[model samples]
Target chain A: MNPTPDGFSTRHRGGKKSAARKVRRSSAVNRPSTVKRGKVVSVADGNAAIISKSFQLRSMQRAWNRFHAGSLSHWTTTIIIALSLTIFGAFTLLLSNANTALDNWTGDNLVTVFLEERTSIEQIESIQTEISKKSGVDQISVVSPAQAMARMKNMLGSEAGLLDSLDDNPLPFSIEFRLTDKKYKKTANLVYEIGTWQGVEAVSYDQIWAEKLAAVIHTFRFVGIALTVLLLTAVALIISNTIKLTIIARRDEVEVMRFMGATDSFIKTPFVYEGVLQGLFGAIGALLLTSLLYWGGQGAAAELGAAFGIFFELHYLQVGQLLIIMALGIFLGLIGALISLSRFLEI
Target chain B: MSSESLPLLIAKGLKKAFSVGKNSSLEVLKGIDLSIDKGEMVALLGDSGSGKSTLIQILGTLDRPSSGVVTLNGINLFALNPKEQAVVRNQKIGFIYQFHRLLPEFSARENVMMPLLIGRCSPKLAKERAGEILEKVGLAGRLDHRPGQLSGGEQQRVAIARSIVTEPVLLLADEPTGNLDSRTAGSVFELLQKLNQDLGLSCLMVTHNNELAQNLDRQLHMIDGCLAEEERGK
Candidate 1:
């Protein structure tokens, strides 16, 4: 008999034939009384159970371990994510500034009606009363010819001296009013109707420029959305591929874990966390990059505004918008991990 | 009917076949019937192509038999779903491969702590148990050493410690000492024998060493997808 490490002789058992017969006989009547029905025993009791806090904590630890082990690849993927999100953020900034500028320019929704040079002051008053009665018209102002000429001189700045050559005020008296309804079509109809009225020489409104600007903003929004979708998809694919490489590198580890009775979630949760971390860090980096762009572009934006004779200010993303970008980054990372895990990690 | 009388594992008519190409099939295990009682150590001796590893895998729930019923602790292993089978594998079975298969990135203690962690054991408890088991396997001083930093014998000892750390009812080792030299292989075999006796851990080890096989309770010799002989150990 073989001596065991404890210096005792190993127990001598029956022959193979007797043991086989016993096993066969036992198999015939084998029914375990301890078997529980419809209830899974906890892992602590030497049975399979769902993931516990300890398991989740270990998974998180492992994710960090993996991130550290493969920092180069992880950082590369993170940089790509950061760059993609930065582009998205820049587009958002541009759209926001354009929208703010449009709002400032169209805030009053003012329309101007120029009267004939021969029109009497009483006629101008009657016309103002008529326009005030029109639907959606508010805040009527009557502009005398001298008042119009004075406004022109103010606008002309240093060139106001050229207007002194005129013997009389050549500007026509005009009526200006704010439209409560800012729809282009409605304002156009109102302007056309007023232009045909007696003593009215021409009718004009800034609604046309507002409408054009709105159309441009709409197109920019569409293109921005399309580009963002494409770029985000690319980011997801990059993350997925990076995770796939990690899976491949750790294939043996996965198999060993599987054989050790690791649940699918137990095996998958760490990878998911890895993806989430990558996305989170990438998003933070993108925010920094976006902030730098905003700060650096502030002076240039001011110069452009001066050139256009208007004030343009670049605003940083609001809290809600920043939170959304962060959330999107996290979501994309999660999706990327799921995609890779689903295709590559069978367990 | 009694727990002591029932074998720890029982397989009846286990068969495994693989498709070769189109019309031909390769049969690896043809109706293999086997059993290992609690605290019994059985040595499976076979040639390279005799399906010993395949049988071990099927018994361990790592691979499914084409047609068979594997009962462990009186539960039909194959009858359970994949998830349930995984739990059974985790809580009831421990596996040792020839190459040790210790994760290169982890320390010996950490590697041994893995199965316990996978079973949802707390890290502190796992660490303590890992330390205790590593001390048992004569690797207390090498607890924090990685597999690469250790010798082959030390690595195998770590693997042994990892396998028994969970206190699994059944240990399935596939040529666990196949890659070691004779001296190291003998020591490793002795460790397995000792663990089997001391812990009453049922073991089904596949190996080519007839001398080591003779030390077990029984020796099962497989030839060409069949058990050709069964001999009682010395």
Candidate 2:
């Protein structure tokens, strides 16, 4: 149940062969992994308990050796695979950042309510009271028409003369409030609640623009996933072909293996390990390339953002992302090798 | 498991046929029945295309008989699943070809250690045992030499060392010294005979050499897919 132990049970009785045999029989796994499952006979009762643990280590050791068996073509194919995967990793980071940007836009969390013209002080006070009493409203501030005009004049500075041409103060008395985190749960309901107030003329927030950004981000994500699947299939085919070469080069070895009574799993395991090795290395290279691209992309992205209102900064892969990348590389290689070897091992 | 009193190898009505084309088959072996006792060394002699090689392949379980049963030590070999049959082959049988088919990249000792490694023996023990067998074949000094580096006779010697390393119940060799010179072939055959006697290993070898066939415990000649128990004068 622990998954970490080498899958051995330590309970023991007398020197009964059946008792020792019981420990080996418990594994539901019918097939052996890298380590050949050990035969627990011949050893004493105490020593037999640790046999699975020993074989577990041996399988890993053998796998490591087999992974490094072939070179020239293996290296070339792996490098190409790594480059393709790097492009995949980079796009994954971009898509992640797009979602992050949309979240941040929503997280600004401010609501503004515009008041009717000629609204009295008592009416403004009542509106403020109602806004504060709302479930998600954290703090409220009411800006009078006169105060708003004065603030605009100070902001305009030299352009204050342009506002003097107006016959009367045009700015509306508005109420501004900071919403709590709970505001996002039912943003539309809260907006509707404030708009129904007697003195309120209109209620406005950044929700429309944020929703638009979210839609765009979702579309990009869908496209990115489709592209990634296609690229991964290509990687698998390349690896399968490369492993085919390795298998062909070692036909003599395989022939000898068959003649000597080696099981299909026994012969195919080393090749799978070899594929995994290539995949592991390919993933490491991909990870490094992604890191470098992110580092280099920071300036280019900033400059491109300046031309359009749109802006995003490339985010480097997170720890979880890195783990995923590694897992993907290994899985691809494993699958690629398996796919390749299966054609040759039709028996 | 059946009773252990049965012969080590039993091939009854063994027939092998290859499909030459659509609806046309070339029958290589026709209803051949044979048995070899425990610890017996037997040689099969025949001219080219006499079906000697095909008979051994079927007996070795490398090729399935078109219609027949090969029982090894009372267990029906062909009846068992391929995986189970392979396990029996690994632990119970050894094979040597005319050409020493050692992995070119591996050294002599490593070549011998391969089957033990495949059987999941620890590397240390497999290596130690491989070294011991190489010594037995008088190649103790050639431990590190690759098959390509070893001479014709030495490579054959390494092949012999590998075949006996697992202490198999049966060894199937096909023209083990066909490519070697007469003197080298004689020496290799002598090494094989010595190992078979010293280790109590049973053998079923296929060769065209009458001189070599005369030295075995018995000779069976294959004439056009039919086996004749040939008599010999010492």
Instruction: Identify the leading candidate in terms of lDDT.
Output: 1
lDDT by residue (A1-347, candidate 1, tens digit) is 32211111122322234332432232222211112442343334322122344356667776877786665889999999999999998889888888887887677688999999899989999999989999988889998888988888999999999999999887899999999887788889889999999999998887687789889999999999999999999999999998998899889978888888876776788899899989998899999999999999899988977876678887888888788789978988899999999999986
Residue-wise lDDT of candidate 2 within B60-114, one digit each (tens)?
8888999988877776778766766676676678898899998887789888877
Task: Encode model 2's per-residue lDDT on A97-205: one tens digit a residue.
Answer: 7677666667766788999997888999998997788777776899888998998999799999999999989889999887775344477788898799888899987
Report lDDT (Cα) of residue A87, candidate 1: 92
Q: Best by TM-score, which number?
A: 1
Residue A144 in candidate 1, Cα distance off native in Å? 2.6
Clashing pairs in 2: A35-A59
Stretches of candidate 1 off by over 4 Å are A1-40, A43-51, A120-123, B17-27, B81-84, B122-125, B223-229
What range of 10 consecutive residues in model 1 chain A has the weakest lDDT sum? Answer: A2-11
Q: Compared with the true structure, what per-residue lDDT tens digits does model 1 show for residues B82-157?
A: 7777777776799999999998877898888777655544445556678888998999899999999999999999
Error of 1 at A147 (Å): 1.7
The per-residue C-alpha lDDT of model 2 at residue A343 equals 89
